[model samples]
Target: MKILRKERGGHMLDSKLIRNNPESVKKGLKVRQGDSSLVDKFLAVDEEWRKVTIEVEELQAKRNKVSDEIAEMKKNKQDASRIITQMKEVSARIKELTDKQKESETAAQKIALEMPNLPHLSVPEGMDSRDNREVRTHGKKPSFKFQPKAHDELGRNLGILNFEQAAKISGARFVVYHGLGAQLERALINFMLDLHTKEHGYQEVMTPVLVNAKSMTGTGQLPKFEEDLFATRDDNFYLIPTAEVSVTNLHADEILEGEKLPVKYACYSPCFRREAGSYGKDVKGIIRQHQFNKVELVKFVQPDKSYDELEKLTKDAESVLQKLGLAYRVVELSTGDLGFSSAKTYDIEVWFPSENQYREISSCSNFESFQARRAGIRFRSNPKAKPEFIHTLNGSGLAVGRTFAAILENFQLEDGSVEIPKVLQPYLGGQKKLEA
Candidate 1:
């Protein structure tokens, strides 16, 4: 198991990066000083196996010819024992070659799968998340005249959040929104969907929350992050962690017209994640829940316009927070912090006064044809031109559950009340405040 060092650039590379650069994969293995000869060994084994198979085939052909001679001899009342013995040896040799072929193929596939993707030119060299850069900060952090309350406390007092009831229904790390909280969550969903579809020119869509194993692997979720997903035993389907899986795969194995090069879509769905590695982080609130609602934005664009589309996509996500008057900052994730399929990722972190730090509310990323290649989503430049993979980008307009939590934490007054943001007033039934 060779661990490749993270490379320096502005963006992370797609998983297929190794397929595009075979030498880099070997160099990566060499860097770890892990049996760099395995690649050549596999190739040699494969070549030898092929040669042995051909030899076996030639022997079998001779055996068949001799067998025919024996049959003709038997017909003529002559000896056939020597021909039968030769047939047995040829069969044994064939079996040996067949077994060797299987071994070589298995060994080759094992080595192939272990190869890592090449680091993108834009990905900055870093060992871990600590090296990530803070790109920019948006709205000023609100200064509370008094001590601020955490979202959990504020939500419980206001009779909007019911963790105990949620625990009874599901298990721990789940939340039950009641009355205004429920309404507010729904409003956020509608607001985001409408904004993206009506203002941002995205097509609204609804997708399944449970997807098959192939769908998971197509997005680089399986084979690597399987434990972080909830799988159904009977059908082998896993609950989706984000709408990205479903929306981006809508055109899987299909080719679209060049005119539709940039296909923008917004979807509202309930996302599920096992959060297998997060044992004690954000355990008390909706920030790290087993399930949550989010309005997701996905786009398929021409490779040339992908980076520009990423900026527009990021702003599309930002508009939600801007409308809600949420104080948030945009951070450029370092290579180590980038997700499995993203080349570049921008995380929108909203201020949480109680925690006295910013927390991630949404992540917008440009996959640069990574998912498109896996999913076989392509677009033809002309009616007769060859199809090429389209760049895929997705982001959460906002995670409704986290947005709800942020609102409670950031807008809570000293008197144990939560003020509704002006933009959400209409959706909140004109209610100005949430109180116990």
Candidate 2:
């Protein structure tokens, strides 16, 4: 008898974990404010599939035994037609059961793919962003003698940003950076790339801005967030919302040696998004642009050292702001505030002087094995060892446009001029400030 091979669509959550520790999965879903009933639904389908599989196996075993008996009857030159007919009936039954088994497995795996990753133990439980805990703050908030102007106004006054021209060219939620504004944006991108590659131990990479649907799903962006994405007309390709999508999937369906446990990449790309649900929020500035530039940091590491690597990744991002002398704080995202694929997250909010508050400039996240599992990224501990899912992590080393805005707002002089940060001065040919 030949055993039927099980087919799978792609890598997903640990099926064994879901089957054995169902209650644990339920608790995790509950903590994330997700419906725990999904676990029950998955369990029901999974159990049904298991039962069908067992029945198919039993039928196949019976057919194998009957075939052996028929072979013996033929060798003795006896009548074997009745038993041969019985074997044909058993073969038909096995085929029917096999079809049912495939259907049930597909249904079970569908539910499994829809489920989100479980939050890490260190991730605090909460209902929303308000419950997030502040980890630390860096640098002093710049004190202005007079009321400061917003970055949009400052950019317009200096003749470095043209919103009107941008609207005429590309509709709203887009901007045209003129002269020094464009220079500052370019400088920030280079500064971040250099810092991450030269100092932070990451290899710089350039990736495609347009990716296929599978690439999107690999990074946990599709299947649930299709509305928020910008797709091409004829193809199933999507314009990436962040460099994370492209960089993190660089090692998709790959297996690495144990000696190269932690592989890191820093990529610079122009990101696109539909911003579907964020109406009337930061609509006046490049903060919520339809297209913007960012330097993304991605890491694929062994599971045991992922969290430790997370801290270092965060610090690497923070170092960008520190070098620019921007005041910012790090906040640990609670369960509900955490991203869909992230087990834990830290949002680095930069201080905005005009708003008298902070806004997110970067989000450092540890996806653990959630993304790795989905993308089929694995690593073996030794030559003879079994391959296991590698942990994936990514963060905006710094959103370049936001950094440009922060520099404009935080370093604006009372004389309507914006002082260039010392670190960025060399990149701009030592220009000290931008003035009208």
| C-alpha lDDT of all candidate models, in order | 0.79, 0.89
Best-matching candidate per lDDT: 2
TM-score of each: 0.81, 0.92
Residues 1-436 of candidate 2 have per-residue lDDT tens digits of 1212222434356777878998998899889887778788888978888898899889888888888888998899999998888788889988898888888777776676677889999999999999999999999999999999999999999999999999999989999999988998999999999999999899999999999988888888877889999999998789999988998888888888878878999999999999999999889878899999999999999899999999999999999999999999999999998888889999999999999999999999999888887777889989889998899999999999999999999999999999999999999999999999
Question: For residues 355-399, could you state the per-residue lDDT of candidate 1 as single tens digits?
Answer: 999888889988886677666778997889898878889999989
Span of 10 residues, lowest total lDDT, candidate 1: 1-10
Off by over 4 Å in 2: 1-12, 58-91
Q: What is the alpha-carbon lDDT of model 1 when measured against the actual structure?
A: 0.79
